[model samples]
Target: MTSIEPEQSSELVLRLKSGDVLAYEIIYNVFVKELLATAYKKTGDRVLAEELVQNIFISIWEKRESLVIINLRAYLFGSLKLSVINHIRSLVIENKYKEYKQVSFQEDYQDTSNLVDLQDLSGLIEEGLNSLPTKTQEVFRLSRYGNQSTKDISSKLKISEKAVEYHITRSLKRLKQYLKKFYIFLYL
Candidate 1:
């Protein structure tokens, strides 16, 4: 077997503590996909995975100054694992509560009520759009919110139809990925 770089984690951590935003971004860029994949595998929810990873990165950035991590990779993965477990546990609890509400409502001759609220979904969608890259976000808004056709979007933005389509598709795919986490919200 090949020898590993033992001090690599510490060196990265040192970079982080010295207020290197790029170092922090490098860390996030390196681990975000794996962290999200792990969360999705455990919970089978893409939206939750994305949201959880976003929060993880935000937390990491916020606490970077005080962080005392020996192994950055291990620390990040461990945090991700714990977050996934907590997310699943919360989902279980929410499901149980929903079931109980359904049963009780049925007994009282009431219909099933939506657990998620649409306003929340609208807010989340807006947030997701704003989080997208500028060009991607603009194309998405023109197509989705402005109700512009792909051809219209292309003409208006002075881009090719294919480029408009590509941006819209990518934006929708990302939105759908995050929305899947709040599938219950869609019902509302």
Candidate 2:
């Protein structure tokens, strides 16, 4: 493990907290390789690992003013660990949802009554989706229905990954609010 002396790490942290772009660049250059290696070891996917490291640096930059770091390397590694875990959790949930959708679709196909209810629910959800901005709706559909990764969506949409995330997050919040009344039991 690479360890920085306390004094140097403290100085770097102070620079980062002050929103120094040069300090941010220096810190990124210093830690990016190690962070990428760590993420790759955890994920075993080069592209995903790269994206994870990039997102971590972007997060650090965006949240610079609120960042409090006693040890910059430790903080960066901790953030990487959390990001990997969250990514894994999201994959698991997405897989489960995909399975549920497949099974439900099969069941609905065999039963006219269930198919009617599903059609109705699908219509309501479509209406809610349509209420979002065009970009947000497109992003949400690409993620949820097309089963595209954020990186893929960003590339296809010619938007940043952060923008993709932002759109999906906003779309979900709006959809939840709009559908909560009718789907209260389903949500609970």
Among these predictions, the greatest lDDT belongs to 2
Q: Rate the local accuracy (lDDT) of all candidates.
A: 0.81, 0.89
Overlapping backbone residue pairs in candidate 1 total 0
Error of 1 at 130 (Å): 71
Put down candidate 1 lDDT per residue, 31-126, tens digits, no spaces: 777788888887788998898888888888888889888877788888888888788799899999999989887865532233234565777788
Q: Evaluate model 2: give its TM-score.
A: 0.57
Clashing pairs in 2: none
* Residue runs of model 2 more than 4 Å from their true location after superposition: 1-3, 113-188
Q: Candidate 2 on 1-188: residue-level lDDT in tens? A: 24467787788778888888887887888889999998999999999999999999999999988988887888999999999999999999999999999999887777976676578677778988999999999999999999999999999999999999999999989887767765774555
Q: Top model by TM-score, which number?
A: 2
Clashing pairs in 1: none
**CA shift of 126, model 1, Å:** 60
Estimated TM-score for each candidate: 0.51, 0.57
